[model samples]
Target: MGGRHVLRARRLMEGALDGPDGLDEEELVRAARAVVAELGSPGRLSALVAELAAGVGDPSGCARLSYRHVLGFDKLLLVSVGTRHMLRAHVWHPGSHRAGREDIHNHRSALASFVVRGTLGMELYETAGDGPLAAARYRESLSAEVSDWLLEPAGRARLRLTQTAEYTAGSGYALPSYALHRAWCASPGAAVTLFLETGAGRRRYTDVFTGDGRDGRAQAYAKEPLEVAEYLAELRALAELIGGSEELARS
Candidate 1:
């Protein structure tokens, strides 16, 4: 526990020579030891940390972040810096939503997302092997019968989780590149989570993997590049099937 003074986020100009930028490939992964020092009591962090946690708890309620010139997007709030992967600050618009889409910028890196406040309903999809044309593919294995899934598995798993698959507030989830899933808000409002990557610079593959593999959530044991492509493609396809966007796919 530290002082009661609120946490003031230190600003780093994007692309500027700062504590976060200018690292090459190797340094990106095994860089200097990074840590987030708890500045406040165990009960409370600075205003910025607390605010970020609250936003992730309820993303639908989190309106897109807007600051005169800047668009208040949930994505913007999930900012990353240095090697610690600490959230310096966040800006959000309550009761907001976005659709299932890809970052498309870099797809080669391993990514993870964690939820803090809100709830989320996520699903994975894939594309048909017939070659990118056939209405996209979704991961599905006959679970004996759909009813069997509920009776045999649900009765046990349901208690621990919402039947809707919504991860509640105060909880966070880490999603891989190939896990194409969307967040859904319950009857309440916006929810939140953090998206993180293992590598650096502009990610190689798209951030969100359009599922096109066998395992959406869990890939095979092998670490082949095809495996990465497979799982990732499947993830994206699933998200695309419905409206991966915030409002449409929002649970």
Candidate 2:
């Protein structure tokens, strides 16, 4: 069942990419939501992820899928690179322990996210300025770029509440490029999400910021893309930890 869901997602993404011109944010969101609805919950999605990872095996293998951990959660890259779009599975643990209640940030490319498991509370914000959200930027030795932001003591940048939503298993939402918002997991539980990014790019970059200058938290952070082999290992480890092996075989 779980493997079927992964296949279903792959088919949906392929179809969208193969469409006459291409899928926009709305179309992509609808497609991803369909997959989430089919998978039913985050646990189901995790099983599929584990199954895929276990199949990939070690570094000498030839699995095209890759992975990375960003902002705390383990993310599995579902498709190959140089494609028109990208699909990622975000696996979050008990709390926002890696980055507590994330500071305000936004993406350059449009994305549609589905909550496969647990719950996530999203807070959307808006500012008077027409530029992107406030953030610090840095370059990494691995040739990847990183960005960070503070949320407390908002300082001169006043953020206006624009929208708020809580997404549980089977629920999904879409965000346009430059949409300013942050998310936190509901207490006492883990969360899993699937994100479909259209027109993705490394050069596009991200920004993070805090509310005021008094907050001592570091405003800069590093980010690097995960290699395919390492990503497979992470998935296999997660599969073992989550007891998805039995289901993975059947998948």
Candidate 3:
């Protein structure tokens, strides 16, 4: 049953990506929105988790890719189609220490996210000629050998907040790879989101901005991948959270 579910999910995603219009930005965003709506549905996601936890099918080695992101969230990779596309479940725990919550950054690939279990707040920013908000910019790259993040100081940047919005469960949004933004859990409890990224025209590095005055030196952060046992445990917990939540029932 789990194997069948996994196949169905993969096919659904592939169909979206291989649509008639190809991978144009508009088409990609449309596909992402559709796929996220379908897969992020409580029933579908819960079933997928149950099957993966039961060890029914190989998740394309994504089980080992799960990790705690530096921005204070658990990124559990659910599916990977090479480097072209990735589907992940992001769990943001309440009261978790957010080391880089104030750091504004962008992704290397176009992405979208669906709030599955709680409210999410997002703020968008753009570089300005002069602004009260000043930041130290960094060019962030990943080491292929060790998967560590290398942050090289770029220069100073002034930015202006352009937009702010809040999304509740059953809602979502998409963004281009160059969109500068920061997000956090706005609800009082744990929040879960389904995130998808497309690797078409992925950039080699991403721009990161930090308000902290650490503009003089470079920094490196280690990304430790989760062990298989730990990964399975997380999947099981997610299944329970989605399948047994009263709030989800009410929603």
Candidate 4:
């Protein structure tokens, strides 16, 4: 992937964010998917991923992130963080295990994920019964505070599991800001997922929930900041991991 392909990918990303405002949540997702689909196409997917991997060669352009809120990841790599969007890749190394199921949470921005390696178990949930009370369990925070994600005790509201599926290499998924979802990897090997978050349509705050959607308990987690040098090393490792995947086979 050269600079030309990288420029093309950036254009697609910007197109996803340049849509009209005031559209509904589903419409937002659709708009994002329509643009993201072009980047994921068989003709250009490899170049896009290669360009993202090549980006790591520039020490000034990459960062390593310790997820303060999301856990159970051996590594999380930040490819880029822009004003209206961000790109990240999550890697779960072999033998890593999460203590418990991940929280079912909603994002403030729309998201699209591409499975670069291994498999991911994805589940989406819809709020049933009292939507307002259900949405109140979350607190708003603009800073880096993991404690802010604690679920407040709101009365019980039903959470209907809407969709459950496994996305493997070459597969992608789009999610609206209003969709509540969680993910896990059942395989014994490593799993890698790349995400593109379009922040243009984001809200000020998003909601969070425990596994059962009723538990209000949450423990604050720590964050580790990574320097650009260390992030470059990690990016090199990730690029190799991705290059080895069958998903990178050219059409």
**RMSD each, Å:** 17.5, 5.9, 3.4, 5.1
Worst 10 residues of 4 by lDDT: 242-251
TM-score ranking, high to low: 3, 4, 2, 1
lDDT of 3 at 26: 66
**Which structure is stronger by lDDT: 1 or 4?**
4
> Residue-wise lDDT of candidate 1 within 1-251, one digit each (tens)?
11122223223212221344465544433221121222211222223333333332322322232111112222332234444343322212245543232211122433444444445555444333343322212222223333111101111000111123555534444433344343444425444443344434443223222323323342212111223233333223322322243322322
lDDT of 3: 0.82
Q: Which stretches of candidate 3 lie over 4 Å from their true place?
A: 99-102, 244-251
Rate residue 155 of model 4 by lDDT.
41
* Model 1: CA > 4 A from native: 1-73, 77-79, 83-108, 130-164, 200-203, 207-251
TM-score of each: 0.36, 0.68, 0.91, 0.72
Q: Model 4: how large is the Cα RMSD against the reference?
A: 5.1
Model with the higher lDDT, candidate 3 or 4: 3
Candidate 2 Cα errors over 4 Å, as ranges: 1-8, 24-29, 35-47, 57-70, 95-97, 129-156, 200-203, 212-220, 224-230, 237-243, 249-251
lDDT of 1 at 249: 30
Per-residue CA lDDT of model 3 for 1-251, tens digit only, reads 23766778878878887666569876687778788889999878877777777666664376668898887899898876667888899988888676325479998978889999988899999999786689889999997778788899999999999999999999999988899999998888888899998877789999999887774688888888888888878877787667633322332
Q: Candidate 2, residues 34-78: lDDT per residue as tens digits?
A: 544554454665666665676532322223334334456766665
Cα shift from native, residue 192, model 1 (Å): 2.2
TM-score: which candidate is best?
A: 3
Question: How well does candidate 3 match the true structure in TM-score terms?
Answer: 0.91
Name the TM-score of candidate 4: 0.72
